[model samples]
Target: MSDWEPKIVSFLCNWCSYGAADLAGVGRMQYPSNIRVIRIPCTGRMDPKFALTALREGADAVWVSG
Candidate 1:
């Protein structure tokens, strides 16, 4: 149980959240391995079906960042 971690599906904007995540990597910042990133052009491009698909595919949570 202690070893369990939430599996998250994150949809991030290419020039925003994704860039921050890339910068975090360069800065050696730590983020949870549970977060699975899917880069998108913009949050506006994100579809509701995407989140639903992620959930149906077994993700514990979904995050959208612009």
Candidate 2:
């Protein structure tokens, strides 16, 4: 069997969490390549349906940051 990596969907707030992500990138931090990032205007605007959809679509994990 082929090795499988977990697929992660990350929802980050534009003002804060997005900057952390950017810094991680700029600092050349190592992270698994399977994570997919989605930038949102704010955590207050997050919809539960988005996480549900990500799970339904076969993402192994989901992360929400503000």
> Model 1 over residues 1-66: C-alpha lDDT tens digits?
998899999999999999999999999998779999999999999999999999999999999999
Question: lDDT tens string, model 2, 1-66?
Answer: 379888999999999999998999999999879889999999987899999999999999899999
Question: Can you tell me which runs of candidate 1 are displaced by over 4 Å?
Answer: none
Cα lDDT, model 1, residue 15 = 94
Stretch of 10 with least lDDT, candidate 1: 29-38
Cα error, residue 60 of model 1, in Å, equals 0.3
> What CA RMSD would you report for each candidate?
0.8, 1.3
